[model samples]
Target: MSKQKRNTHSPELKAKVALEAVRGLKTANEIAQEFGVHPVQVGQWKKALLADSASLFDKKRGPKPKPEYQSDEKLYGEIGRLKMELDWLKKKSGINLP
Candidate 1:
């Protein structure tokens, strides 16, 4: 028999329950039974909370923001490398421009 998945809670409610489960006020099994959800889901929430707690200590809170990459130095390095390649190509192809 195929099992049906039922998402009975909203995102806000899920987060609330997960946070409550992570807080250890009640066991995951208890929360799962109360919420009519699987214990595995509550366990997953607890695991996620514990794994991510260290990053939450900063001034920023909530979900961690995606890191901003591509520094100016990397851009400059790429430009220089491309310029060198262009110069080499021009010399090899004997291309003269106005």
Candidate 2:
């Protein structure tokens, strides 16, 4: 038996096919045939498109806030702790660091 190559569809094509299916003018089988994909796949795409459609407009209009790694006070405290540790180590080793 010969192996059949799988077909890969682009996002644009998926959106087009799913939109056509959503229109309900033609059945899933017809859309699948036209797009050379399975009817179930067409249905799934339609469902996904409908489900995610709401999220398309759910985004708020504004500049997104930047992520903060740590607060300024916390970073300064850590730096102070590190300096204290370094000074103790230098004093213990009799190495005077100016």
Candidate 3:
């Protein structure tokens, strides 16, 4: 048996087929045949388009908000403390670290 090469459809093509499916003017099988894809794919695209349509309008038009966490100064202080403790331990053990 030989495996057939998979077809990669562009986002524009997917949107077109999905829009056709959403119009109810043509069946999934017809849309698939016209677009050279499986009927299942057309159905899936249509479903995703319908489901995500609301998100297009719901999105805010600006940069994303920053996360709330400990400031960089606090983190740097902790790192310095750890380094000092490591240096003290190395000195007591006679372990020279370059």
lDDT tens per residue, model 3, 1-98 = 99999999899999999999999999999989998999999999999999999998998989877655656778889999999999999999998888
RMSD of 1: 6.0
Candidate 2: residue 15 Cα off by (Å): 0.1
lDDT of each: 0.80, 0.94, 0.92
- For model 2, how does the per-residue alpha-carbon lDDT over 1-98 read when each residue is reduced to its tens digit? 99999899999999999999999999999999998999999999999999999999989989876557556678889999999999999989999878
- Ranked candidates, highest TM-score first: 2, 3, 1
TM-score of each model, paired residue for residue: 0.48, 0.66, 0.66
Off by over 4 Å in 2: 66-98
lDDT for predicted candidate 1 compared with the true structure: 0.80
**Could you tell me which residue pairs clash in candidate 2?**
none
TM-score of 3: 0.66
Clashes (backbone N, CA, C under 3 Å), per candidate, total 0, 0, 0
Candidate 2 residue 30 C-alpha distance from true site, Å: 1.2
Per-residue lDDT over 2-90 for candidate 1, one digit per residue giving the tens place of the 0 to 100 score: 99987766767677778989778998888988888898988877687778778788566578665456566788899999999988898
Candidate 3 local lDDT, residue 37 = 95
Query: Model 2: how far is 66 from its true place, Å?
Result: 5.5
